[model samples]
Target chain A: MSFELMLFDNFLIEKQAVSEVLLCNKITEDYSLALSEEQALELVETRSDSLKNYGRIEFGSGIIEKVILTFADTPYISQYRYAEFLNELVEIFYYFKNETLDLISDDDLIGTMKKYFDGVCQGSLDQLKFRELERMAKNVRLGLDPDYNDLYDSEKLREAEDDDE
Target chain B: MNSVKKTTKIDVDKLSGEFYFQSLLQEAYVKGVLSPKESERVQLECLKLLADCTERFTRGKSSSVRVEIAQGIMASNLYTIGIHLKSLPDVEAALFQIENESIEKLYEYGLQVLKRKIKVASYFYNRVCKTKLKTPNQAYNITIDQGFKPFFDHYEINFHAHEIPSDIDYQLIHPVTDLAGVEFVIKYLENLYYENLFCSYFDADIIDEVMTGYDPSYQNLLDNICEQVFLNALGCQLLNAPLHPLDFSLADLDALDRQLKKYSQAELQRQLKTAAQELITNLLLTNPSLKKYLIASLPKITTTIYRGLTTHSLNKVFVPRNNPNIKPIRHYNMGIKMDDAAYREMVTEFLSCRFFEDKLAIIKEQIKTLADMEDLLIAAELKAAEAAMIFDLLEDIELAVLTKRHPLHPAIDAIDYSASEVQMQQNLNAYMRALPRDRLAKILGMTTTIEVV
Candidate 1:
């Protein structure tokens, strides 16, 4: 039962991950969003740092390529700060994966992020992270629909109450 | 013909049992048998297996897990692999399989072994239940009854193969150690089955009497009952007497003392072991495993006998039976009680009395039966000294009946008695402890054999 001595170093995984991330560029290129090799490696490094910070261990190819392809066509992202945007998005995705208690799948969580970024978040990563995604994670934890919002429900109730008054 | 003998560089005997996989890898690496590249490949494959397990754990909905969950899956995978490796004929074969096969394949093989081990564990558990001793010992009863239910119901072999899920509390003469999970349970049940089989030779009621003779409150003790029965049986064999009663009389003790005083400690152990072997044969025990189990307990039994001999307390080692069959020589019937109306009035007045002397005066005047006196003793909040004086009014037989009926258990049984009862018990116990040795022995001896109507 002892795993105390086994190192979880990602030195070998990072090279493979970097190539996978660069392969996503061929798809993102159609959307005018492309990452250089350096940018791809940085994104992989960002995934590693986020995993460590969040006390998580990812196996296999991870969700980096998935995140890149999923977020490629979003109007919020562009080539100017595409690498930086992906890095922050990767970190936020991992942080919320834990916040959601792993009940939400990788695909579902990434799709929800893309929906909020283009919709109410209006391309604001901070809004998506701090506000929309936080609410969604809370809903998932509470066994409610992932899109359930008490704020919106209360607002509607208050408007109806005022109409009756 | 040329043949190369592939010997393992690692000494299989020195590896840890609980951490078999880790220790085996460690010894292999230290001996330079497993190169750095091979070790890395194993670690990576182990991680890959963990990742695959995590996916199955989460139903492939998540790509990441908390580090603890991952580590648990990793350890379970390694334990599974270790089980398979251990099933090999020798350490060399184990090492060869580890070097040549994929960890996933080894883990699959381990799962197969684990599946078969579960059946083996089930067989042992059934044997243990069938041969379980009938006793009033709570730990022994409950452990046999309910301890392994959780293990059979919810043993998580996929992720927690190294964790024992049972709550076994009874102590065995030879405790199960250096094993985990199902292996630990199997060894424990196997030993218990043997102990039960040994104890089954004597009558259950006689065993209880012998335990009561050992300690009037031996039911609460965690000591193994079988060892005592075996020791007493061995004592009977040494005395050339019948082993059914499993009791030693005072004359038997004197006889044993004179007989064994001649042997030195080593000679005493050798004699006891030989007697144990003879005792086994007398009982017609042909099972080699049972014979071996009895012989294995000789060291502990020998130490006990040796200590008893040196201290001149062989009576304590080979205890006499408190034969419930013995008729009491004297019986004192508690007379009829006063009517409830007068008893109620007296208790109210006694509770109203401010001084201890007044309450004692009321008790001496109104109490007609031991039953009413016993009731008032509890209802009244008398101090220890007051209770002791009240206890002095009863005869030895009356006191013995009260003592037997309301035996003062130690703090271990504190939770069962009420505060008022505990106060009365402590007072009664202190009074009995202050009595002369013969008087106390006579009272206690009567308590065991006396019948109350």
Candidate 2:
């Protein structure tokens, strides 16, 4: 469909479709990209330190809790861990999308996004990060020059968009 | 082939400069036969042509004089825009600059009229000046500098004081946001109002800036902008079309042509009606709370403009699809068309059944008062509009409508003007633009009276 189809995006019932596509693409599974299920679990353990490190850098700890609930259950991980990570990750995403994204630069957003992305790749986060490109494309379709560029890796974004779609 | 290339007695006369100009329109003439990078190619040619035209045409004129002349020509682009908008096929498109591709690229006027601003978040809402004007037959001065006054007896939105543009008339009105404004532009330009183009310079790169998105390669933005410009023109065309004001359906007036061109007339109209209807439904019928934003948007003067607008009488107050008493309401607002009494009576009978079966009088009275609000205010301010405003009563009228048509669940309604008063009152105009509906509401004079009888 033409890019103007973006306006109809308001009618979309779920953004999770993008996430499902990401998981199916096996993007997060790319161990070759320096991230692996083992590393994700370790990151989760370090993040959440359920046993110790309970009270330092609460935000970072939150990030840890965030990663745990998010990356919890794959063929490599368990569902219990998945729920924790999903719960924390979504709250943070809302915080970032609703709160900090605009005041901060894409550099900071990408930096933070990269941290979350580090926890889960080739799966949901990658697809979600890449979804912004479609929004830009939609803006182009709607006759708005979305004054944001120089913000992402275009080739990776294109590849990710193709994969997500 | 070699002779044709090298020695084709290139008869410059055969060109009338038009053909060479046309050839130059390609990458070869101005770029010295370089590869056609879209911007480079188009920019180099048009600019070089513009330069050549000015330099040669201003023969023996001082460079300063040439610059001055160029500036004047560039300034004329505004006139061009006014004319272009005049031809728009629909009102919405025209107001939004629908078909005027690359309009934003045109020099951003340092002096901007009031725009309707939305709040970005809980702490900030941008103030947007929403002005609605009906198209008129002849130019009328809309005295602007005399500005607006705070007349709020009811309602919570802030009323802004504006300085009317004195250039058009001692009256501050610039002519787009009022019925007379449309007429002002039309009558002023019966003959094209040619300005001295030999005086100013046009910013040649702004269109690219406006149309270029984060993905620089996105070519469709320009196309869409163009389509919008055209749609805006279509609005003008629709309003100006010879349909008797009584016969207009707004649908019969204009249609939008955008990326999808294959849709038939009915399909396109349905699509447009759907979009326009969203605004109408929200503004007139939808509960303000059930929706994301308030319909008590920019139009501190919308109803007044509606009354002034002779066309589209049905728009006086958009009765929801279910409102049975809407038929009598239209007659109540419009009464009979004095010029075409026969046709008007015929319309009343034919359309009345579709509108309502009961309580026509009260509904009619309500809509009539609603329609008269703007007219009464404007007429009152005709003598001294700037320092004094007649909006307090109208604002109350608006509040009455909102309160009566209260859409909020009785228990969980957000405070009215929470978005505007909290954010906009703080003067965070530039911020909160993107996320306009996110402002927090100020708890000033909210109805907390739970009268549990």
Candidate 3:
């Protein structure tokens, strides 16, 4: 077999393992929406298509696991949106990885994404992806956040203001 | 020196209109040319004329431009005063009559006029001073002032015996009495064909085409002494030699000329032939199996000829602060002419050799080992060559790993090990690949790798 076919087979196996774990997580245990073999393959295909759209390729690295772990504890995350959100988050992670000059660590970027998604974005994936993360990327490019330490600080403060109101 | 007091604060704009009229009146009274009352009346009339000119020049202009125009008017008035006193019997007395404040105001304006005249004189002198003249009996005939005497003395000590040919016009050359003068001479001679010929040949036009053109094998030898002079000057700058123009003594040029004379065209050709034969022998020894390919490719080997110095060399040659023109020598590439098909065939043969595959394997192994290391800082500390090998390997690995192709056994094993490890490997690979090739080469050449911790 060609090396790419072998690698793709390995990738499919790894994706199956990750999908089984994600579907059986404690937060989604109450929901009876388990992904079938075909559904899992579709999820993998969606991931490959999203990655290609961003001009990126994965080497079976678990960016999906990290995104799941980051958003797993959110109160609004439901079984229906879980798989699709993970797919879009994977694409956004790789796209912004290049956009932020690759200076922000993966953990820091995940933390920034969770802060925007849970706080200012208030569980709206569209707002987090299009509005907050885009602005943060621009700030990073213009050297406003050299270390990215304050990437989500203002959003956190605004969340506090909204809670008080 | 008495034209302006060192401490005077002269504002160019403030020295216009009323201020200029007051200064003129003060000068008239001090010189006893007019009584105090008469001077005051004359100053009032002058102020009217000054105001009229200012209004005319500043029309439709902004405030800042108006101020600039007013300053120009004041300057014109000063120029008129200068012309009036140019041939005055007591010019020094009239100049001394101006108050310290007025003198300070006019200092820059007056100095500019003097500078322009000096520039004209220098231009003419540089052009006409090349006529042949009898050499001075004494080395110290140029009476440089006491402050400049030490620099001139050092020049004499270094280049006393080195003189240009007596047949060349002295008027064409600047007398190299100081460092700046030496630089001027070098700059002038750079464009002159005669000086270039002198650099290569002991006598001008000695090589005749009629005598040397009969033999098809004959090659002409050009003097490269001037290039050597530039190199040595660059070396001197790198060493931080205190004197300007990075002095090249006459004796050094003469010695270089003699060395060039020793290598005849025929002898140089013979040496080149011997060098080529030795190179082929060495190449065959290194790769015995590729003997046929080497033999075929040897005659067609075309190396790029670098025409000029690098940026670093140019920087050293013309230290920016001292030589602001900063004309970096132009660099160009020249290669041996070969048919495209033949060149492509040669390249294919060379790339397909077992030597390239062996090298690629070694580099790949080194990269995989470095990628496996837990601490990136330890990998960073590898020798420059090892680091360069790792860098190239990482680029190839990244391309393969990303595309899911060229699956090296070890790399595939590493991919199966853990995600974070793979991520770390990818990050390091990208970082190293992003670095400049020259930088990677330098790092690899070093004994120890750079410390990242």
What are the lDDT scores of the predictions, listed in order?
0.86, 0.29, 0.41
In the range B21-46, model 2's lDDT, one tens digit per residue, is: 23222323344332345434334333
For model 3, how big is the iRMS in angstroms?
35.4
Off by over 4 Å in 1: A1-9, B1-8, B35-37, B215-221, B254-265, B307-316, B322-453
Q: Which of the CAPRI classes, incorrect, acceptable, medium or high, describes model 1?
A: acceptable
Candidate 2, true inter-chain contacts retained: 0.00
Residue B155 error, candidate 1, Å: 2.5
**Native-to-model Cα distance after best TM-score fit, residue B200 in candidate 2, in Å:** 28
- Candidate 3's residue-wise lDDT over B15-90, tens digit each? 3222232453444556564566555444443344345444444341211112233444544554444423332334
Best by TM-score: 1
Tell me the DockQ of each model, to 2 decimals.
0.44, 0.01, 0.00
Give the better candidate number (2 or 3) by lDDT.
Answer: 3
